[model samples]
Target: TDIPHFSTTDWTWAKGALQTVDRPYGPLLNLLHHGIGSTHVCHHINPRIPHYNAWYASALLKNNFPDLVRYDSTPIHKALWRIATRCTVVSQRGGIDGYFYQPKPSI
Candidate 1:
């Protein structure tokens, strides 16, 4: 299957709660959990920290290792649309060992 990949929106309380639940529950809970949205990357890096403190940890990571961290500042809706429309295929080219995807080339 061709899965779409895009940057995650900033973590907020509503976003964090939504991440804890399944996708179907997102729309209803996103606003309420928006604060937790951005700390996702931090959580993945260090699960020991509680969600409430993930944001602070994420900030430290971003500051210390900006290039290493995959922090996306895009708005959630816009990032979704961009991925849906542009990321159509996944491929691994020669010399590139890992699987990855890119947007379709412009005309």
Candidate 2:
């Protein structure tokens, strides 16, 4: 994942692509949460956009980078539990320069 020629913006986009998950929880719930829960990837891509405009930006990002944007529909509680239980460890691949979350080992 380490590309030596990538600029800081490119690196940020790459990180956001890997880590940001915009979880849609209905319009009413999204409104209640001020769009943070649903338009999180937009937030990561550009933190300056006001919450009111994040939806539009998120849609734009989704449209332009369909392969890169991660729209996770998993319930918040379940995702939290999964992360808590299985995402604790980070390890670097042998001879690699970066660290990544280790996949959970099968029993």
* Strongest candidate by lDDT: 2
Per-residue lDDT of model 2, residues 6-64, tens digit only = 23544555564456677767778777888888888788778899999998998998899
Root-mean-square deviation of each candidate, in angstroms? 9.9, 5.2
User: Would you list the C-alpha lDDT of every candidate in the order shown?
Assistant: 0.54, 0.71
Model 1 scores what on Cα lDDT?
Answer: 0.54
Shift in Å, residue 20, candidate 2: 1.5
Question: Could you tell me every candidate's TM-score relative to the true structure?
Answer: 0.59, 0.68
* Residue 40 local lDDT, model 1: 57
After superposition, the stretches of candidate 2 with alpha carbons farther than 4 Å from their true spots are 1-18, 26-29, 94-97, 103-107
Candidate 1, residues 1-107, lDDT tens digits: the string is: 22222225434443343232112214434446744555655665666887667657877877996755554555656666787889866666565333457778788
Model 2: ten consecutive residues of lowest lDDT: 1-10
